[model samples]
Target chain A: MEMITSAQNSKVKNANKLKKKRDRDKTGQALIEGYHLIEEAYQSTVKIKQLFVVDVERLDEELMTYAEEVFEINLKVAESLSGTVTPQGFFAVIEKPVPETTQAKQVLLVDCIQDPGNLGTLIRTADAAGLDLIVLEKGTADPYQDKVLRASQGSVFHIPIITQELSEFIDHFEGNVYGTALENALPYQQIPSQDNFALLLGNEGEGVNADLLNKTTQNLTIPIYGKAESLNVAIAGSIVMYHLKG
Target chain B: MEMITSAQNSKVKNANKLKKKRDRDKTGQALIEGYHLIEEAYQSTVKIKQLFVVDVERLDEELMTYAEEVFEINLKVAESLSGTVTPQGFFAVIEKPVPETTQAKQVLLVDCIQDPGNLGTLIRTADAAGLDLIVLEKGTADPYQDKVLRASQGSVFHIPIITQELSEFIDHFEGNVYGTALENALPYQQIPSQDNFALLLGNEGEGVNADLLNKTTQNLTIPIYGKAESLNVAIAGSIVMYHLKG
Candidate 1:
């Protein structure tokens, strides 16, 4: 395997930047970590920029077939390139091309959920519900961030994603927009889950803003039976997607 | 605000332990940061071993009433006490009391979810669904660990949680047991989501072990309509909880 000891190596420096949200934002690229995540990136048919595989001999022959260019790096070298402890012994630098968000027949809108893991999972759930696009309004975590990408399991590659001015985008689509609220809203299941709908979710701490709520066609809430103040944003979004689909 | 800067100080040392999973496990304590999370911990009526508010005057009057013993720690002191990014000017040392896990007719069994955030969200969802109790088998992330505790948002304090051998616990649970899977499982919505049934979940990556599959009375999966290979495990668990409750 080729040795990469110098932390100053250009590739190493770029991979490390992915750990922070700001660098990820400025570069418009994400570092995909772990074997499965990188595999999913390839399987999604997203263009691969560079693949850094540690212990290259251990990689399955099938995965190697998809690599445009593969770099063999030792575990120590990979660790220097990792954002997490126990780096999956490998990572990839994928150019984050803004996805081609299709015309919204049915869509999903996410307010600034802030937590990287939560946002990623919401995108995964949205893709599963067969929603057309995910719009990341202000205050949301970087979807292309390494943690968010890993949480999404490469669904970001397949799903159409757009992060832009929310009000302008919502005004353009104007379909049946439903937002989840804690109280004073009809039960999501009771509301009759719709097909061509854009499910909007707000930040974990605050529900959607009044201005945004005024824009929604309807305000809906998942009934909470127990003592919990609310559900995790990701879980809430997923449950809403399921009920609204059926 | 009382400023204590020495890392060797008793409180500072205790809070620093929270950064490591091992120390948090050994002490049976989690150092919760931020006014919002700490306030939620109090509002939930969870017992706190100690309250470390960085700015006492900044706290809402309602919250100040709850801290029986509030220590005002300075920002520099708070930074050394903080487990995460620039301390939110607040911290708390909460005794991770093991909840009294009642043997009910139903429960949620976690096999081995490794992500602390996912585990915490699951516990929160379990509480929301009004499940009987939560049982975490070995290999699961420690529920009392700081990250999981934060994610639970005091739901850990509200719910009855237990950790033990999976095979042994399921062997005695006296109701219908369902596990999440891909092919063999019933559709989540199709099954009669029972309030008195136990739900089982597996590791995020490897999934449920083959041997454990025999122990479950039934297997269920949230049907995916789009391109994702699988839904996030925590979402999968929460969706099943909602369906079972319905």
Candidate 2:
């Protein structure tokens, strides 16, 4: 274990750069904060590159045992390195896992979901529904964003998330792609259950992209019964994902 | 129309105090920001007590005609009074509607849901599912909190949300009360559909209070298919609500 007291330390500065999407992409390393998330990541195959801590006493033996390297940093440095309002004394830099091809039939393909919280919730929901994979199009919010990680409740560590262009994914995917949209869509209940299917969702404001929607085998809609114009994107996605998990 | 330049004006000071829970409760009035929410409130039966705007030109004729009173304030004053990071130039003080007895068959009972965004999302989901009402237990986040309102996306204006003790609500409610928990609960799919039912959701950390759970007609669980510990409270509530909306 190394003690890092200075915020100006070269390692600390480099690790902090993982906060940006470009840096994370370039290095294939993302920072996961909080004791819980770090512990989850520690249990996963994703390699932990480094661990930073304000106090080692707060960490469990399992995390310490699994960690590749540990650094004890001062509170000032910890605060500067932290992303959340309440820092939980531990952060891990983990190598982003290589995107794995999905073998299972049920999948969720998300297109242009810009909200971090929505994207995180969708990932968590997909995990809970027993879906095999979640495919994100290029325009979706970064899954590595701190708010996304926090909102996901550590599901990011569990779920297999892959990012690629929606058009290519839809064309290459083996299952029937069911797109979600408001107009010219069958009520979600009316769509016949399939043994192999992919659920596609879109941005918060716009429905699924027109060209993408046309490419899907069918489009589905969750009926809004009350004065509410529509359900929040995450909630709508969850409702549909759970219903179609059959 | 009234033009107020001073933030220290008596009405402005009184309106500002509504930001606090105690003051909102005492006054039975809460501020709703943004053109969309204000417009929703204007269309609803709920009385608008006062409307504040930095730009009179942005106010629609219908809103101006419907508002009980309108105040034009300086941009500096508007910014100072705004709750959101990006203020939408319009704010309204709306009288809290009196709690009415629910007439429909479906209801949602939330117990001690502490996250404002979760509570709001749950309410919005309930609205989308055509639930008759939302009963918030005392420990739940205040429905009128700015974050809650923003998260609800104006559903709060449409949904009938009432606060009362959970014990009393369960005892008096006409429909079957279905509680959600992780253990010793039937998978939500296995639970029989009810003609009239209330879905009960609990806090983020602790599940439903045991005493309240005991009083419920049945306990339901959404099975976790992956390594994720659990779904976000709002997402979990939504899946159950939509599934059981039979």
Task: List, in the given order, the native-contact fraction of each candidate.
Answer: 0.68, 0.87
Docking class of 2: high
lDDT of 2 by residue, A155-228 (tens): 88787888888899888888789999999899987766566889999999997899999999999988888888
lDDT (0 to 1) per candidate: 0.79, 0.85
- All candidates: TM-score: 0.84, 0.97
Best by lDDT: 2
Write the residue-wise lDDT of candidate 1 on A1-246 in tens digits.
345666677777877787776886787667788888877777777666667877777777766666666677767778788768888787777777677756777788888888888888888888887888888897788787777887887788878888887777778875788888866677877767666788889998897877888887788888777778889888998988888787
TM-score of chain B of each: 0.89, 0.96
RMSD in order of candidates: 3.9, 1.5
The per-model DockQ list reads 0.63, 0.81
Which candidate ranks first by TM-score, i.e. highest?
2
Model 1, B5-91: lDDT tens digits are 566778778777777778877877777877767776787676677777666778777666665556777677777876678668687
lDDT of 2 by residue, B119-221 (tens): 9898888888888888889888999998898888888878889998989988988888999998879899887656699899999999899999999988999
Candidate 2 DockQ vs. native: 0.81
Docking class of 1: medium
